[model samples]
Target: MTFSLVARDSGTGAFGIVISSSSPAVASRCAHARAGVGVVASQNVTNPALGTLVLDALAGELDAEAALKAVLAQEKFPDYRQLTVVDANGSTAVHSGPNSLGVHTHLEGEAAVAAGNLLADESVIAELLGGYAGSTAKAFEDRLLDGLRAALAAGGEAGPVHSAGMLVVEDVPWPVTDLRVDHSDDPIGELAALWALWQPQKNDYRVRGVDPTRAPSYGVPGDQ
Candidate 1:
């Protein structure tokens, strides 16, 4: 019911995740990332806590594979979960539980990893990785979104995806980009539109959080 990609941008050292699912608000549960740490996508049976646990391990200076291993080791039902991790060094790791849904698969590539369950075919994972890797010239967030779009074009999940989202973390303690289309007929398109609207203001919002005096006003009411 879900497909996701976790990746690190080699050019900017940013980490990002893009996800879509038949379930509403899928990314709220599946996407996780921390600045200077790593990114995690925990899906399948959808234990949202696994995202936090794996991120915690990554924050503890564990590598991607080691972080995933540490979290799964403590999980009571590891066989029902699917997880992907990409650490700060661009190392990637993935786990597909034995009890994963139909046509489930995962792939790891240079600086990126992709996983999907209830997929139209396993090839979706490969296309996702290729899409991100092939778009090295684009901005980091666009590359991540390209991967999600490519997976959908290559045959995404077994059913129509209703929700889609993207998360990106840079040097700050908070996400620089967090966009979601919680429920929609074309969630990816909606998410992309949101990204377009957010991109120019992303850095401004970060500045607002850290130093409001240096932040640019959006010319909205009361902002002046």
Candidate 2:
């Protein structure tokens, strides 16, 4: 019921995840990333807490493979969940449980991993990775979005997707980009539009967070 890609940008030291699903607000549960840490996509049976669990392990200095293994070691129902992790060093790891839904599969590429369950076919994973990898010249966020688009084009989930999202974390303590289309007939398209509107202002928001005096005006009523 879900498909996702998690990636680390070696050049910028950023991590991101792009995800979509037949379920509503899929990303809110599946996508997770932390600045200077790593990114995780926890879907399939959808143990949302696993995202945080993996991140915590990464924060504790575990690499991608170690972090994922540590989490699965403690998870009560590991067989029902699918997880992907990409660390700050561009190392990647993925686990698709034996109990995962129809046509499920996962793939690891340079600095990235793609995973899905209840997908239209196994090729979706390869297409997602290929799309992201082929767009190395693009912005990290755009590459992630491209991956999601490619997976959908190759054939997404077994059913129509209703929600989609992208999460990115850079040098700040919070996400630099977090865009979601909670429920839509064309969630990925809506998400892409939101990214277009947000891209130019992304750095501005980060500046506002770290130093308000140096930040630009909000362009609202109170400023002179």
Candidate 3:
């Protein structure tokens, strides 16, 4: 129902995801990210807990493989889940089950993990991973968009992408800037444009030294 990408920026330590899905409000349900912790994409049979729990495990300095093992160790039916996790340290883990639909598969690497079930092909995962990992950029948002675009080009979600969203939580989280498409015929394109609008505003706050990305620092630009 969704084709999404999550990425980490090596330069700024930012994390973000861009996604388009045929399902309603896919971003809210399918994409989860925590800056300096980890990202979890839970699909097919979505498990939101995987997002928070996986990030907790990652922040505890667990390796990707070990963290994933521990998370699944608690699940009653692990094989029913399709999940991908990437730690702040760039370790990755993915699970695509044998019982999943025909094209189901997952690929994990140092900086990225991708998984798709009921997809056009298993190769979609690798394509999404390669796009994000190889995109050497300073901006987390751009890297994430690259991943989404790649997934779309690789035959997205076996259907048209409808909704999109992006999130990156730094030490602070006021301006929030959690861009969401809500719904769109071309969600990726719409999300890219929305991000363009958001960047200048973000920089405006930055240049005036208004620091909104931090949770407690969003005060008048110069008076503080």
Per-model tally of clashing residue pairs: 0, 0, 4
Worst 10 residues of 3 by lDDT: 209-218
Q: Report clash pairs, candidate 1.
A: none
lDDT of 3 by residue, 154-210 (tens): 887776768888777554433235788888898889888998888756655544445
- List per-prediction Cα lDDT, in the order shown: 0.93, 0.94, 0.71
lDDT of 3 at 11: 65
**Residue 163: error of model 2 in Å?**
0.3
- Top candidate on lDDT is 2
Candidate 2: tens digits of C-alpha lDDT, residues 60-167: 999999999999999999999999999989999999999999999999999999999999999999999999988864689999999999999999998999999999
TM-score of each: 0.97, 0.98, 0.81
lDDT of 2: 0.94
Clashing pairs in 3: 172-213, 172-214, 172-215, 173-215
For candidate 1, the 10 contiguous residues with the lowest summed lDDT are: 132-141
Model 2: lDDT of residue 203: 94
